[model samples]
Target: MSVIDDAIVWLNDPLNWTNPDGIISRTGEHLWISAAAVALGCAVAWPLGVWMGHVGRGGAAVVTVTNLSRAVPTVALLTIFPLTAIGFGPKAIILALSLFAIPPLLANAYLGVREVDPEVRDAGRGMGLSAWQLLRKVELPLAVPYLANGFRIAAVQVVATATLAAFVNGGGLGMIISRGFGLGLASGGGQVLAGGMLVALLCLTIEGVLALIEKALLPKSLRRVKHRPPASVADALPAGS
Candidate 1:
């Protein structure tokens, strides 16, 4: 039978979906792990990023870490963490995934606050607003869209990365893929494909939720505005010059 046909058969088999270790349980595990990783990442990154941007300091430090984190491969970290005392299971995976999540969250929050109009900052100051009040009322509200976008990036990344959990004997749809790998091309390739599809679907679902949240909380103008492209060299030159 075709791999696609095999997958359909596998999917249709009620026995394959028994509660404790089935797709349903695996997806639940995936969601919680991804959620924990993202929550921890945002908690660490968002406040520091916002505070630094508001103060107009730490941009260099923040970007340096963001770049460094991006450069570090996820596989390397996943492998290394298990060797430490954290030693396998969800904690190790969660820690690795959370680090993977931090760069976007931190960078976006920082940029969002920094990008707020100087005139707005001045207006807030003019209103006898304290530093805390300015950040709370003016900067944060304006920065919300960027923050949400950062959240979207972080959450999607964590969900996708959590599939690697099965490598460390944690849990997720990767189990089915790993089993398929053992069964070879003829019999179980469909299992691998199905596993991958589940992960992709999870990622899409996360992105959809984030999109809805962004739409509900932010106006269209503010969505993803932090990532404007640079002007071309011609556009950079003064018109008269």
Candidate 2:
């Protein structure tokens, strides 16, 4: 049978879905780690990004740090994590994945705030709005799109990469993948394929759900601006043309 056929067979086998080491159980563990990483990334990056963007001092430093984090390899971080106090568990996996998630969230939030119109900001200040008020009332709403985008990017990345959890004895779909590999290429190929497909499907589902939430939560005016149709050919043409 073809690889796809084999994977389907492996997936359809009822026995694979119920045991302690089953798909349902592993997926739950994977999502937990991924969510935890995203939560930590948001906590660490979002405030700094917003503050720097608002203050407009030290933004360069923040960008530099974000870039540095991106340069660090995921595997290297996971490998080194074992030597530190955070050794070989879900905590270690979460730490590594959180590092993976930070750069995009920070950069997007800062850029979003920076991109807000100066005139709007000036008007807020002229109206006697305090710095905090200006941020909350003016900038935060404008920055919501970028903030949501950062979440989308970070969450998807975390979900995909959380496969690393299995390597350190952290449970996730990756454990199934590891087990498949242990069984050898010919015998285990179907299991590996199934595990990978599950991760990919989960990431896609997460992206779709987040996209829907973003659309629903966006300010109505902003939503209109985003979804407004382009001018028709007749409308764009010269008068009577």
Candidate 3:
């Protein structure tokens, strides 16, 4: 049988879906670790990005740090963490994944606040709004879409990358793939294919859910409306006074 056919058979088997090492349990483990890493990345990067953008300071620093993070390979981090105090455990995996998630979160957050219209800031100040009030009310509202996009991107990336957890025996969907490979391809090819498909499906699901959330969080005016035919020129004109 073909790999796809075998994968289907493997997936349909009740035994594969039960037990402590089942797909369901592994999926939950995958989500938990991904969530922890993304949350940690947010907690570390978001506020700093917002503050730096608001104050218009450290633009260079933000760029440098973001670039540095992006330049480092996540696999390299995974390999290096075992020698550190973090040890070869879930903490090491989570920390490595969180580091991988930080770049987009930081860059988008900075750009979001920085890109807020200057006129809006001036208008707020003219109304006796303090700097904090202006940022809270004016900048953050305008920046919501950017923030949401960053979060969505980070989340999808983390979900996909969390498969690396199995490399350290951290237990996630990756473990399924690794276990399959351990058993040799001739007998385990079906398991490998099934695990890959599951991870891809999970990533797509995360992206779709987060995209909907991002759309919902947008202002009503900013929400995408269906395209319509142009109105006739007469209809475009105001009624006779």
* Clash pairs for candidate 3: none
**Model 3, 1-52: lDDT tens per residue?**
9989989999999888886999999999999999999999999989988988
lDDT of candidate 1? 0.82
Candidates sorted on lDDT, descending: 3, 1, 2
1-241, model 1: which lDDT tens digit per residue?
8888888888887767775888888888889988999999999999999998899898777756765776798878888998899987778888999998887888778878998999999999999999999999999998987788788888888888888877766787777788788899688888778877877888898889887877887876767664532211122345553
Q: After superposition, how far is residue 14 of candidate 2 from its true place, in Å?
A: 1.7
For every model shown, what is its TM-score relative to the native structure?
0.89, 0.88, 0.88
Residue range 138-174, candidate 2, lDDT tens digits: 9988887778777887898889888876776678888
Where does candidate 3 have its weakest 10-residue lDDT segment? 225-234
Off by over 4 Å in 1: 219-241
Q: Lowest-scoring 10 consecutive residues by lDDT in candidate 2?
A: 227-236
For all candidates in order, the CA lDDT equals 0.82, 0.80, 0.82
